[model samples]
Target: MTDATLAQLDALPTDELRDRAFALARQRRDIKFFWDLFTHVTHSDDNTQDGWIGSLDASIDDAVALWREVTGHHYGDAEPLVRAAFIDYIMQHGK
Candidate 1:
């Protein structure tokens, strides 16, 4: 997502965030499943996994920044599980 899009999403109400999260989660899950299947079929090594981690870390930074901007709360005290899940999704599926 673009920074503008992320900001728009962040500006949404809490209920909208929940709904958007659900939609994003479904997309993330589908992508992860397909990526896993492809990797299994190709018998790829896990050595390339760091790329995904790096992408996910970038995503986490964006998310944390958005959360802080919208909610006026430090990212450190934000919901850890949600942050972790987002990171996990990116790590598993990001290109």
Candidate 2:
């Protein structure tokens, strides 16, 4: 990622970061793909549903910009996988 991208991501709140990640993942894959992945990962598990929406509000733009840099592609091509991975990780790890 570029310095500017890293700076942007570093400035974002955790929740926003997560959101951007999820959005990117969704872009990479289809809704069904991400949904299935999420369901499979969270099955039989207690996943936290709070705080995520607000964690990265401050840095959403930067996070998204940084995400593009990290993936070397625009959101349309990379978001789904990024989002899915973020969701999967958070669902399994509570963060």
Question: Please, what are the lDDT tens digits per residue for candidate 2 over residues 1-95?
Answer: 22324445545555565665556544554344334433443333354233332344435344445334433443343345444555444443332
Worst 10 residues of 1 by lDDT: 33-42
lDDT of 1: 0.40
lDDT of 1 by residue, 1-95 (tens): 32334345445554445344435545554444323322332234365343442343344335434334443432233334344444444434433
What is residue 69's positional error in candidate 1, in angstroms?
28
**Candidate 1 deviant stretches above 4 angstroms:** 1-4, 30-95
Q: Note the Cα lDDT for every prediction shown.
A: 0.40, 0.44
Number of residue pairs clashing in candidate 2, backbone atoms closer than 3 angstroms, sequence gap of 3 or more or interchain: 20
Q: Largest TM-score belongs to which candidate?
A: 2
